[model samples]
Target: MNNAETLDRRALRKAAPVVGITEPGYADHSVEAGILKSIGAEVRLLRWEGKRDKLLDMLPELDVIMIRDLPLLDREAIAALPAGAGIVRYGVGVDNIDLDAARQRGIPVANVPDYGADVEVADHAAALTLALVRRVVSRARQVDNLKWNIAQQEPIYRIAGSTLGLVGFGKIARAYLARMRAFGVDDVLVYDPYVSDDYLAQYHARPASFAEICGKAQIISLHAPATAETRHLVNADTLALMNKRTCLINTSRGGLVDTDALAAALKDDKIFGAALDVLEQEPIGENCPLRGLPNVILTDHTGWYSEASVRSIQEKAALAACEILTTGVPTHWVNRW
Candidate 1:
């Protein structure tokens, strides 16, 4: 063989599989690099600038992709994926990914569902709930502005005898209930249709309709996924059903609540207050009405975040990528062809 042809063959034989990250957010890629190296794969940051061109440019070289918050992987993007490539979402929610498209293309898609973020999210939900009920955030702002003795100005109800409501009975919801129960939340009305009555009874919670939860519970927390059915689950009708003194807490998907409806409710004092760790539009749009609302507290979707949680998710996601690259099978496969 010619010298050039021999060198080309040698290079092809030594090529390593590349695992690209849609957008690199972590301090370093050491964890992903270490895990995927065992399977002869290297990690590459796509550095996707929220543009389709950036994704298309990187798709050809990637054998697997690990995604976090941005860059929605739609059908077009799925079509551009390398043959036999796989996708692994960094966290639980795969709403940003096109699972059906990946399935049709015979590309396996997986998510790290049990990376120990349940505790962090549940704790964050409880913290938001407390801040909402006790007027902690608002009161702190008031105190910062030199306003004191405002207890009666903004009524702070006792949580000891109030009822708690959970929109979903998942691991995070159950953990949140455990925390609220300590604060004397004896009555818990759950609105998850998927959970059985016996299952809820084990947690001393009773199943209730959505309207009943809004009408009866003094504090309602949402923990549902963002599917078509669950999108805007908290809208005008549901918000209208809520007692005026009720507080809403959402640490789950932002799409679960209608931002406009929620803004109107808070403006009219339809509900007592709301503390949100997630928003319909992240980084919050400039025109968002909830921006300066005293009755609303907004956070930048940090409920599922912690130093430990970040590391755990990174490790789990890398392991999933390694598994898929080595065996063509992911641990928590979402798209099973």
Candidate 2:
């Protein structure tokens, strides 16, 4: 090749395209740089917080971004970014990403549904179930205070031979059923009209109407997804069906259970206690009533996070992003094509 042609190619190589990653110093990721290089892309990871100065400087070279609760991808920010830059959300839910706006700009948004979280979530629900049935949280303090009480211990229930009702028959619900089988929970009732009865039977679970499940189970675990139809699946009316000593577990979306209704049910001892891994609003405000309630066991949504899960998440999430950016198709994506 001629020297002039070689110089032109060198210049083009030096001006490699940049891929933006908003979450700087990712916890368990190693694939980002290699993936970027393979596609003739330059990588830039940032912790930008809608800062005008910093964003303006980085905007020109960026052609793709990995969004992790970063700047809103609304019309304004979309207009502000360099033309032809697409976005990829890290996980299953894409509510944070502005899909309509991205679509309008010819920028595709992507999400990975690498759902290893199912088992962990079911385990979390079972943990809550054990905590509630044994009054683990409730009885611990009294013992610590050296006040041995009999009546406080009398209501403690046994999980063995008890009925476990699942409100939804998603992946998590199946995992929960798998685990509950070993717990001596012979009667597993599932409530999801979409799943065929024969399909559920393979999981060792029987189909039950929502009302029947609500009224019968000694332990209830919610595994429904967040949808327009299931905004408040467990409302006051359904909650009222639960016997006084029933235990409720919700590792599913917080909106699945009406918070106010749950608080009322807990206060009234309508259900013996509840074990919730989610709340109506995450990073739940300090003034939230459930936080103060003693009978309830509250965990800050850690059901989807674990050491191994984090590494898997980073790998799968990176793949999902790269897949969409290069191929314009999300392998684990949820929405329309």
Candidate 3:
């Protein structure tokens, strides 16, 4: 065919299949554009918030969706998509994605099961732990308001003397422990039956039972992922076991902690204040009860949002997206290939 005829034929044809993004605020480095040019593929960013009601409507014509929240493709949502489109989770945790639904539909779900992403969360956990113990946010606010009586506004609890209990001995938990050691904390206890003794000894972590970690430690930091067994792990009963002076810190998956029970405990002063970067809900609204409390240092679900870390996640995710779209082989499929 002549040049004009060839152009017309392709123009009448559908644009190549694209890789769509479910999350917003990623550094767009033309990786998608490059891949599309290399092999008749396109990449689009949807940037939609996946609430229960509107998730289905937000998804556009997609060959593949690279998602941060794994559970974005529930049975109802997945049913809304056309066949042959794949599902790819950009990050490690697949708790939010409906694996059974994807498996049933033969839609491959992928996740990069790596420690790199978890390290950012671990570092964030340490930051939140120290911020809570040192009352950094409240102190900053007091100074900003020109009422610089920090000691009166928010008391500084000594972390150096306190014991820090880690719930899970994963990569992030180990990172938090290293940060703690730097701060001169000698009492670091961990409660993960899965973590081997040699690794614990190497990290200078004392292996404690769950009850011991909750009861004896002055600060308890959650480092577990959101699994069926871990949902609301820190419920009313577990919260009751916590030291009255304990400060609960979580940078792990939100479902790991019970928001309702934690809110109640914070209200009643059953425990010291909490420092949380992850909540059961993302894009936590201003009206969220936790937002109204001064005792709780709540972040806007941005624990894993450092420039360096997010860049790495986006790069790998983009590559993974391209790989699936081009090769028909979903890299890092989380639901057992």
Candidate 4:
């Protein structure tokens, strides 16, 4: 090739914008690549294995980053990112990303908050609640072990006359309430300072404090975010307020519940049972206390997963990255400068 041709190719390569996927969990990057290609952007997979040094090394030269729950973009990581590089979280939570740090650095951060996961998340929460209340997992195991017709071994409760308590009144929480309402759970107490009592009344729900919800409801479900104030919202003190017939369900952030405190409560039969989708720690640690508890049902933080939801989040995240590259702004910008 001629020298001029080689120079022109090099210039074109440098001119093309680069978008990095911080953690590659999706099956393929076609959705991102296809969207980014219109703006001459190249999709680069970082495959960050939760390593600080490696992430720092690869931070330079990227115009945008798309991340999903790995190698937390904390203060240091946020500072390491190239100046003005936009960060897009694939899901609703930004707890892994330091929004304040990004704002300080003049880096805009966005999240795929409306990725259509409300239906899936609400459905999962209800399924877990039903499983826990009816001892579905335990009874299935009993039958598997050749112990049939053991209905008297475990007591079951009816959902027809139960009071439902919700920690947050977000989209997912409201969706869950609708499902529970169909099952005759009309009496509801919601604990969201952001939501007004009149608004709660529209849904036939009364606004209550966290303590009131914990103490009064027969079934308490956590739908709040994981923040400084909400961390360990379900601790020993809150669990103590729950009666023996109370059942707990958490499909939101795992950090909302204290793992050790919950295990201790279950061991002591403080509550009837509990079901969890997300945990404070991902891929649950080997020594995690909630591992072998039969009363507790656990899922691999997949409450927001479905083929359609996955596609929706991927498309939305890609569009966010595309906007940041082409327009220097995202539609759902959270941490704005």
Candidate 5:
């Protein structure tokens, strides 16, 4: 075995296990630190600060690595990890990680899929849908600028008796459906080929094609994953099927929608409005066409954030690390080879 692998095994046996975190936005790692400390592990925050080489250099020393969304752990980084070392994602979405490389290296990768953010994301989607349908943000802006009773300038639609469409009927989508149902949304249409018809019937939602949902539903919310089949599911052709009264809300993967098509639709008033918690490119590029659209509402992809959810994800990720260190397996293990 290499010196790094030898050192790691020795550290695991004699010294405290080393767990490193990369590019965390949290104020402190106290929660994760406490969890790892309880298992006799040392927590190190490798805030490489956009320095990829530095992070690569530190990977060899860690028995486990916990990461969020930033500073992607690509193949090179994964290959740098010593044998027996494992990686744990802070939350769902392992697209940023090079899973194939980790699997090839026999380095187990795990993620905390259920960190209790379903409610938060669903609430955010509902909020965005309401804001778009009611012209809430525009009205507030006009009211702040000394405009009175300007609601008539832009038509507002009542939430009751409207059709709700969901791109994916996962946990977040189900939670969003419940919230919309409370708002008097009776006719629900869902387009998820993976789910069975019985599953849709259980929730009182009708299974429909993507075109049908776009053409029929007044409010469409996206809760799909980012995959090759799902990318750009909302493209020009689909946007053409939407009516002027439609409102699109995406709290899921940004790649699910075609930004250019949506922007063009908004520019032409082809749809009512759109609210998004995610974008095709994060920190949204300056050249992005979606910016400066009055009818469009954008958030910093924070739909999965809440104090409780943050704490939950942190604790769960740390526990996964602990499991890797102690049992050589994680609760939500992914990339199994």
Candidate 6:
């Protein structure tokens, strides 16, 4: 190699852009890092540890940013980035990211809406519903404590003839419906304004209002998004409408159900039991009243996870980054400039 050619290569290498990953909780970033490296881009994983100042300090150096649902990227965070830098969300929800701010800055934002997690989420919802309906978790704890024959104390109902209510009839909700049907659930009531009557008929699920589902169904599963209309959809009034034999399951967004109202209902036995995967405040707030309820089941917000799904989301997010770096536009761009 001649000295002139070597100098040209050095200049090109120095011109390569940097991609930063903020507040990453994934086990590894080899896939994303490899993708960025392939494009002659440097990859930096910035574990900010909830320090906004540290994140702000690093943003000016980045050409693209990939983040999960942590250390909120609000207006301040978005403003810290150099103009035209792209942001790629790891998963479907972009509520955590400030899309309007990104749009105002002419920075494109993208999300992986279909990263193959519907099966996992649906399976999780069904698992939580079944566990709550059968009192599995409580009974297991009782057995561990050497308590015997405690099942008779709390009346257990048959699941075969019960009515199942789905709050949203999206892909995940349809998957859940199939699973519930396997258990011989006779009636399926769905409440989704966007879904058509023909679609409900195709699944043999009846279309009903949200209030009707809350009042009439034996098992109500929430699969709605977090929006102004859906926020606190299941509040005190809806909780009151629920039958005493009903078991509520939420594997969707936490904002769909009001935690305070649910806590009150559970305390008074207004509803039979409730299972929740996502909480309004993650890690659960210190004052969360649902913590010690015997009739309530709680799981970390991990319903949309599996070994395969994790890899898929990482690859898709990385691909979005790759697209942005190569063409100044992502394949799944959400915030159009």
Clashes of each: 0, 0, 4, 0, 0, 0
lDDT of 1 by residue, 219-259 (tens): 99999999999899999999999877999999999999999
Candidate 2, residue 132: Cα displacement in angstroms equals: 1.8
RMSD (Å) of each candidate, 1 decimal: 5.4, 6.1, 6.4, 5.7, 2.8, 5.7
lDDT of 4 by residue, 173-209 (tens): 9999999988888789999999989899899899898
lDDT of 3: 0.73
Model 3 regions lying over 4 Å from their true place: 1-15, 23-29, 47-60, 82-84, 146-155
lDDT of 6 at 298: 97
Better by lDDT, candidate 4 or 3: 4
TM-score, cand. 3 vs. native: 0.85
Q: What TM-score would each prediction reach against the true structure? A: 0.94, 0.83, 0.85, 0.94, 0.94, 0.93
Better of 2 and 3 by lDDT: 2
Q: Candidate 4: lDDT over CA atoms?
A: 0.87
Q: For candidate 5, lDDT tens digit of each residue in 1-337?
A: 3334533554556468789988755877899999999888999989787888888899998888988877688999988897668899887888788888887676888999899979899899988888888888888988999998875677888899999999999999999899998999999999999999998999999999999999999999999888999999999999999999999999988999999999999999999989999988987899999989998999999999999999999889999998888777688989875
Candidate 2 lDDT, 99-192, residue by residue in tens: 6666555555666556488767778887888888888887787688886865644477778899989888887788887787788999989888
Which structure among the candidates has the greatest lDDT?
5
Q: Candidate 5 has which clashing residue pairs, if any?
A: none
Model 5: weakest 10-residue lDDT segment is 1-10
Q: Rate the local accuracy (lDDT) of all candidates.
A: 0.86, 0.73, 0.73, 0.87, 0.88, 0.86
